[model samples]
Target: MKSTHFLFLLGLLAACNSQPKDKEKETEAKAEQPASHEPTVNCYQYATATDTVRLTLVHVGDNINGMLIYQLKEKDRNVGSINGTMNGDILLADYTFKSEGTQSTRQVAFKKAGNAFIEGYGESAEVNGVEKFKNVDSIVFSSSMKLEEIPCK
Candidate 1:
């Protein structure tokens, strides 16, 4: 009777261990599957005689992730990554960048026009050490810098 009970306990332990192996295999199979939707990538650039700005945006539904580089004349170049959401024709994001060996974050806004994006500007105040527009609705989207769609390279 004691030997039968010991055998039964051993069988239960084996069953428990085998179940986890099956679950691990199932998890591995799911991990190997490709994503249902691929991210859409778009690049844009605005250039002139003295300054140039390049933007690359990747859209997955309404969420956006992108890289922005500003090479303005007589100014320290700011290279950064932006992650934000697209609300109607407006794109609002927080730009986190490293410039002059220091990292900083600031709020940026843009308006979509045809195949181009116009940078928005407005009164900004420092909030928690991050500069953000006082009122997003009051931002002016008439900046001369208009980033036009360009081929990714």
Candidate 2:
């Protein structure tokens, strides 16, 4: 009778030890599952008939921060950086840049078109104490002045 009782106790111990293997498998399965999210960064470059522009933007929550380079051919160039918020596929920011040995600030807007950016152009106007383009319309950019996206560094 003592041996029967001992065998029963041994059987209970074996069953308990087997459960850990199943638990380990469950843990491994959870680890194998894909994460709920993946990080991403937006970058682009555009070439026009008279200029080349590049952008490298990092998304911070709903806002964006990055650099902007507008180089002209045989003319003055605007080189500076930008920081602003995005509305849908559009970005409106204040561009503080140097052109022809002078520094000035202006408000500019850009519209995303697939892998390209269509810069908005309009008559000069003052808004919020800064020089900005008013009467924005998509008709401003010609096909030769479109900016195309390039690989990020």
Candidate 3:
């Protein structure tokens, strides 16, 4: 009877010990795992970009409308052009790019935050001899501005 009880206890210990090895195998499988190659809904949510920008910053008091164009003037740029519709701060342009005189179009995105854009890219240009994207935190077009459409062509 003593030996029977001892054997039963030993069997219980062996069963318990096997549980940990099973768990370790599971853990190792997870640890040596692969990252997610599948796309998730959150990934699409973050990528849902706004189509246009409405200014809410500096002295764009009146309704001014036009297009924006960025050129690779003194650098190595592949393309350039930012032609869009403007309603005060809101711009809806068909941005284009011409590198080596080839043209392609992309929608320009913009948003106004405080004195400047907290997000979005607008065509900062030499408006009236001053670059638009320079020290300006807002767009206040005056007489000196010479609107430069992009792609330089």
Candidate 4:
């Protein structure tokens, strides 16, 4: 029985570790240096999702648009909002805000693409704090949500 249990645990670990080659970077947390100055540019943002994260997108006819909210955690927990265009399940947004004292911008790009599926990556910081968006860089969420359907805008 003990051997069976150990085998099961090992299998579980193996299963969890076995991810596709394209999504290796999604699981790691990202941190950027804090700044305390004004931003030279308006806002910066980026995301690399294809068709995962269905919940974050609202489709509208052939053209889809939605709002992306990035919560700044370190500075003042400030929330940054961006307007994104949706292609199938992928949504893209670029927004910025001030944290401690520095201004930073983040880009939202499509990670995956499909109907009702939305997958992508995005991170941002203000003058004092950093707020990393969840699901933006999750590898598993990218693959499964490719088949999920989201509401049409």
Candidate 5:
């Protein structure tokens, strides 16, 4: 009887010791891994009373890269190719475009709203007798200038 009881105890210890290896194998089989491809692009468009703008953005882990096209009705306009970084709800980009048959670069920013975007307007200054927005962000966008998002074009 003593030998029988000792064999049963030994078998119980062996079973308990082997359970953890099985658990480790299960965990290894179920571990989650990161995706192998980039996400899709997101596009948005808006039209003001006198101008139309379109934006296309690709997001990768909170970073953003996109394009902006601004065209005025029957007037000189800019179609800028922009690359920017996004932080929270704001995107700041350097715009390079041709306007009035001349090429120029400017820094622009956009704030995301619900199904729309609020543009950041800075203070105006005179540079070589031309008024330009400088040090902007003072004027929050009113309801009228809030750009409504249309289908991607």
Candidate 6:
């Protein structure tokens, strides 16, 4: 009876030890599989006589993230990051930026044209210290600040 119990214990230990190897093999198989899609990056810039804005966008599937920099003459430069989603031809995002050593967050919208993106403007109200559009549907996409596609440097 003792010998029988010892054999059962040894078998349990062996079974437990084998489980990890199976898990490792599964992990290896997953590692060998290719990614479904690679992230695509696009850069754009809007320049005028006194202001210049640069935007770099990276898209991974439906998600988007990017950097935005605003350099306007006589105003503090704002450098920030934006993350949001693309709904149809409209891109809605949250812009978090720093200017004059102060941090601010706001919602931004852009309309995609043939080869450029036009910044949208509308009435906004401060909510929880962040500025958001009063009505997203009412936002006007007629700003002259059009960011033209440029090569990523």
Model 2 collision count:
2
Order of candidate numbers by TM-score, starting with the best: 6, 1, 2, 5, 3, 4
List ranges where model 3 is wrong by over 4 Å: 37-153
- Which of 2 and 3 is ahead in TM-score? 2
The TM-score between candidate 1 and the true structure equals 0.75
TM-score of each: 0.75, 0.63, 0.30, 0.29, 0.61, 0.75
Task: List model 6 lDDT by residue over 3-25, tens digit each.
Answer: 99999999999999999999999
Model 2, range 1-153, lDDT digits (tens) per residue?
A: 999999999999999999999999999999999765433567777665666778777666666677788776886777877777777777877777788888778877778888887777667777766787666454265445566777788
Candidate order, lDDT descending: 1, 6, 2, 5, 4, 3
lDDT of each: 0.95, 0.75, 0.42, 0.43, 0.71, 0.94
Writing each residue's lDDT as its tens digit, candidate 5 over 87-148 gives 67777776677787887776677888877777776766666544456765564555355666
lDDT of 4 at 57: 39
Model 1, range 1-153, lDDT digits (tens) per residue?
999999999999999999999999999999999777679999999999999999999998778999999999999999999999898999999999999999999999989999999999999999999999999999999998999999999
Give one digit per residue, the lDDT tens place, for model 3 in 21-140.
Answer: 999999999989976544211000011132222222112223222333333236534434344334545544445556567665555445432333323444565545333453334534
Error of 1 at 148 (Å): 0.6
Better of 1 and 2 by lDDT: 1
Tell me the lDDT of candidate 1.
0.95
Worst 10 residues of 1 by lDDT: 34-43
Show where candidate 1 strays beyond 4 Å: 1-35
| Clash pairs, model 1 backbone | none
Q: CA shift at 35, candidate 1, in angstroms?
A: 9.3
